[model samples]
Target: MAFRNGTDSWVVVMFFMIVVILFPLGVGPEPDILNKISSGVIWVAALLSAMLSMDRLFHVDYDDGSLELLVLHPQPLEFIVLAKVLAHWLTTGLPLIIVSPLLAIFLNMDISSYFVLIITLFLGTPTLSLIGSIGAALILGARRSGALLSLIILPLFIPVLIFGVSAVEASILGVSSKPQLLILGGLFLLSSALCPIASAASLRQAIE
Candidate 1:
């Protein structure tokens, strides 16, 4: 209980501090500049946060030999991989939604856009977690796994990053954001269905 609490607390605190620093640094300081760049700023922070947080997914278990046991379990490896991805979404992606409003404020976002920001994050970050799992699973045994993981996953992130930021920008422009959001949601559904199976296959290769 203590360990779980400590880990959860640390994760939340780290995410908070990292976003607080990153949004401003990426977007710049002028109020007008921030407003103009806020959509991009928030999306970039989400990307960085998602990337950083994913490295720890299998790392914790891999270090402790639990990853090996997970591979060896009688239950299908696909299900196990799905469970881990779900847990990752719960911990990291869920928090991204919760914290995006504050980050939006820092980016000088209009107050009305806050709900759309949260909704977009909710729709988008799961895809990040899911796609990231593939890279994380593939690079599990590499010497520079972290860097390799980022390289492999970064390209895959482009579509989500594009539509996610577009949704916010559309909202701010008082235009319909639904088309972009629907695209983002479709990407999430596709990734959620496929990424775990791919991650499980990659885990098999890594374990072998």
Candidate 2:
């Protein structure tokens, strides 16, 4: 559904591009300053872009009654939620990953850090989707849900945000980014194992 709609993904991509554009203006034209902050800026923007779309994960389904039917079906809701998160990542995160090199160039990111940026995002963004699913599911039909959703999910994203930026920073410094990358991979695995179950439970509660 996210892929078919196209608008959500486009918004995320545009937001990321806009962030990249704005930072350069605010920080001046120096390659040194741009390069210095590139990874952190991009990672933060990516995280926010994902958050901006998080509420849509289950909102439409909930509004249209598809969510009720989905809950009552025999298939495990956790698996269904996992599939949804995967689709969300494909529609949203993958585009960000694909276009990030261009953004990196705009930010004057070091050539060496490119690999780690892609690596960290590959390991990190699906976890973003997974984690966002739980937050979205938790707040289904709640008042002012966007604001509440961020409150629930943003803090949860901190560990991921930290390690993601750290991995690219390590690469820029000519140090091994492997440790941070491994932690990100581990975070993905952990989220994969846990978030879907939590989302499923939240959905069940919301529908009941």
Per-residue alpha-carbon lDDT of model 2 for 121-157, expressed as tens digits? 9999999999999999999989999999999999999
Badly placed stretches (over 4 Å) of model 2 are none
Candidate 1: which stretches are off by over 4 Å? 1-28
The most accurate candidate by TM-score is: 2
TM-score of each predicted structure versus truth: 0.89, 0.98
Candidate no. 2 TM-score:
0.98
Tens digit per residue, CA lDDT, model 1, 33-118: 77877777677777877888777778777877888888899999888877887787777667766766767777678887777788
Steric clash pairs (candidate 2): none
| TM-score of candidate 1 relative to the true fold | 0.89
